[model samples]
Target chain A: MKRIALLGMPNTGKSTFFNRLTGASARIGNWPGITVDLLSARILLGADMVEVVDLPGFYDLHGFSEDEQVVRQFLQNNPIDLLCLIINATQIDQQLPLALQLRRLGLPTVAILNMADEAEQMGIRFDAAVLTAGLDSPVCFVSAKYGHGFSEARETLRQVLERNPPTNAAIQHTEFAADEALLAEAEKLVARSVSMPRVLEHGLTERIDRIVLHPILGIPLFFLALFFLFQAVYTLGGPLQDGMTWLLTTVHDQVLAHLQPILPGWLYGLLVEGVYDGLGTVASFVPIIVLFFLGMALIEDSGYLSRIAFLMDALMAKLGLDGRGFVMLMMGFGCNVPALLGTRVMRSRSLRLLTMLIIPFSLCSARLQVFVFLTTALFSSTQAPVVLFALYVVSFLTAFGTALLFKNRLPSREPLLIELPPYRLPTFKQVILRGWHEVHHFLSRASRFIIMGVVAIWLLTHLPPGVAVGGPQSLAGIFGSWLEPLLRPIGIDQQMAVVLLFGFVAKEIVLGAMAVIYGLEGDALSHLMAQRMDWVQAFSFMLFILIYTPCLSTVATLRSESKSLVFTGVSIVWSLGLAWVISFAFYQSARLLGY
Target chain B: MSMVRLSELAIGQQGIIGDMDAEGQFRQRLQSLGFRIGKEVRLIRQALFGGPLQVRVGSVNVMLRRCDAASIQIWAER
Candidate 1:
């Protein structure tokens, strides 16, 4: 199959173009050794089966950034057919040097100048003849967002592929001996080819940034945005989740009634309450998690996320963490597995490792389900969101505290050189696609642990001709009693203690396992949860969930990404220990205050 | 034109970039981003005390730290 590798600098909409062309949300499989994630898809383009690989964006090929290294490694390791480079049309002058560098590689190459719509709005005009002639390559103007210029580009790519064919030669990689000359040449070419109006026409993005990036207003505006985001998540998502749970459990009950007559009690319980109820419990929360992802997608694609990085760099710097790491940390709230996977873009190993340590402390949506259920059952409507939001604040505190503790050991050398791109309201389609993409990843990667853990917890309670379901003679009861002593200081009893152990597989299972272990479902489970723990104990349990070791999927990702057993081991041990001490302190202190 | 550090330039100020003290990968990054000798750059904005400064180099806006910005000498029109 013919292969085309997509390459570009950051913020060029390269991945957007790749997705539009391929129409697939390609998964990032484990590609070891500094290459954490790379996306590729196979698609047929005009009588040709082509594999399109999206390389991480980087400034210069010779640049020492980890992204640059990954690009070089991929190009050198695998033989590729065509090098397709994407450039932001508005920033062609500075970006063309990269185009020039790619042209020097002697590989079959085609260039796409994306965001042509924005370029046109700014009164930036490009002389196609001059651009193509000067660059000495085939280049096309495109706006990936509107799906314009794609058909012609597709045809152009096919023709280029036919002309060059696949040489089947190894593309030897080497640094540019003199990037200075190539850069000079690119500037000279851009000068003759691209023309722009003086004063740059109008500025919507600038006007918005004036308020959004304003020092005092910026931080508050940021918090307000998050506040509204979470509000929307609950107000809208709560009903959808409640409705979904009702529908699923209604179906589960009917199936259970029929199966209870046909199958033995053990088989019936294993299938219904063990598998269906547990999976359905977590599955119902999917809407809320997807909604959270959509909210974040809007913030990210609007270009405000970068503004956040700019606004927050100083504050986080004081805490010994960079602002960009905070972006990954926010992503952790959706799922810590992706958060660890997302750290691949960073150039510094130390910074990446530190970020991995801090991300697990994020109250991911999996844990969010447990917290929301417990809080709603315990607190009134007005107080539930507040309690939930406080957990978020505490999660952040734990992240910063971890950073402060590890900053000396894992010193980051990368400078805070982030691009504050012009704000563009992200399209509705793009936001949904992002939401779907993340949800799909979560389902694919996390479903195994969710199903397996639920079954294990179910079997533990059901096996050996139980004296009474979920009673002291049962395996779950026996195991929980064994763990009770360790957890006693933290105020978690035997029944809840074992749920925490099962939760290690995946945090989503904590709530599901609770339902199964307690022999309760839906409101009854929540009712029991509320009655079982007082405010102080409930608060301690929430802290324990927030600070404990990362879910197994996250641990696997950390193991693979960090590629250091010692580091991953330390991450687990440290979080578990920190969780114990913090929970113990809060429980003891709160008890003394007579709450 | 008297030289001033990029971090020293006020908001809405314009300058011609001059000798930069950056080295290695950082130099290459800045140079590729259109921050070089004789390039016309502008201070788009600055965040609160000792934070990142938003600067326009050619057509691209970059968020650069104050410490790094201070290392670049620019000839400013007062």
Candidate 2:
């Protein structure tokens, strides 16, 4: 099978194009030499099998961004047979140089001008035939949304392959001197051949931007949108969570009951307390993931995400980051691992590093379960959401403030030159598909972590009857107890401290550890912790969870991305110290104020 | 006079930008986004917090740091 690289800037409907070409078998992986993602698929052509690899989007070939570099390096190393440059017809100028460069490479190239419908609506016309004749290659104006021009593109692919042409070495050196005259000719061709309908002149985005970017009101408005998003998720996901929790708990109980008479005590305990309890703790996050993804997909598909990035570009710039860093931070709310991976969008090394450093501060949805489970069992839903929201705000504010204090010469802002695509009602298919993909990835990751974690926890806490001395008082407890005094001001008892010590492995494991520690008897430990502990303790617990050392994978990812274990070590030490100090201060100060 | 600072330009105002000092090594970065001097520019919007300034130049939206804005010299429309 010939390998065909599907190249374009992100959000140019590259994935949609990939899906159209090859169904579910598209393999998603990281691009070599860069963290930017790559998606490739295998499709059977007329006589030969072919592979289509989706290259990360680049605004310009000359620009030195990671995604750009990913595309450049891939082309340099694994030179594909036919280079298919997918262009969003709406924003052709920014992408044109790369297309021209690809053509210059003299590679049998085709320009699939995607989003023709959008371009047509915008009153932009491209003469595909002229464009083709000028570049001496085929140009298919396609709209992946409408499934337009797919057949033509496929036919072109077939014909290009039929030639069985050898790789042209001349195109490789065209980077040093771009054939601008050829590009001009191509532009002339577009002018001659493409005829666009009269655009319905309107300025809805302009009007919305007035309010959304208002100097006095924009920040508040952005926060308001965020507030409503949170409210919608909590208000909607709450009932569904209760149902899910009930189903899981009921199934667990029935399974336990069925096995009670047949199995030995330790074996039954392992199944019920270790496996079911651990998996159930992770599963409880399902509703939050669903609702969070719903909100994210809505914002993303509606194109408000870029505006939000625009809205915060200034503040981010002041902190040596860019607006897109906000997206990484928001994605971190889903899970810090992927969120860190998503930082591939930030082009600068320092900017990427700073964003990665700050992402763990976002209250990820996984931690939301810990808050909801503990707070609702102890406090009201009204109180729980508010507290969770406040914790999120505090963490974000802390991260922002930290960034401000450490203001150094970081990567300059890549001018917020972004194309704000019009808002459209999200397609149910796309949203559900994306949501299912994320949720399944999260669950799969969680399952792996939880199984290993539960087995380890079972070993640490296991002991003979009446021998609490060996199990809970073992090495883990000794270490946690050693730090109890430091944490005492924050009201973390030795048991909670032990769970946290293990939590450094992975945050979700903290909940799993809690479940096992409390013996998983109808969630009695969560209830007990909430009921017996003062609000200060609960608040302290949340605060500590907020800023504690990130999971092992996060630290490793940071080290790999930043190429600095020193920074990783520094991040861990600072978060650990900060978590202790802040929780201590909150608890102590609140106690002094007679809470 | 050299072009006025982009930060000093009014919304909807068009200008011809001159040299930008590119403070903190940001000049080339901004230039790469079509924010170089000699470019025709428009003040799109200014976000809250006295933050980065947003401007449109040749069908693209580019964000400039407030510090970077001070270095951008633009000929404000008379």
- Clashes (N, CA, C under 3 Å) per candidate: 0, 9
Top-TM-score structure, candidate number? 1
Question: Per-residue alpha-carbon lDDT of model 1 for B1-78, expressed as tens digits?
Answer: 777999899889988665477766776678557564446789988787577899997667889888889889887876
Second chain TM-score, each model: 0.93, 0.81
lDDT tens digits, residue span A1-595, model 1: 8888899987787767887988743544444343345667888899978888878778988775556666776776677888899999999999999998888787878889999999999999999888877677788889988899999899888988898767575565545334335556777998999653223223877888889999789989988988899989989998999999888878877666677888977887887878877777778888898898888777777777788888888877776667788888887888888778988877789988998899999888888988888898899999888888889998999899999999999887676677777777666787899889988887775577778888898888876684677778888889989998899999999888889998887887887798788766787777888888887889899999999986888889999999999999999999999999999999999989888
Classified by CAPRI criteria, candidate 2 counts as incorrect
- Candidate 1 Cα outliers beyond 4 Å, as residue runs: A1-202
Model 1: pairs clashing at backbone N, Cα or C within 3 Å: none
Deviation (Å) of B62 in candidate 2:
3.3
Could you report the DockQ of all the candidates, in the order they appear? 0.32, 0.22
Q: Which clashing pairs does model 2 show?
A: A1-A49, A9-A57, A105-A171, A127-A194, A314-B52, A415-B63, A416-B63, A417-B61, B3-B74
lDDT of 2 by residue, A283-333 (tens): 776787788977877677666777778777767776777777787788777
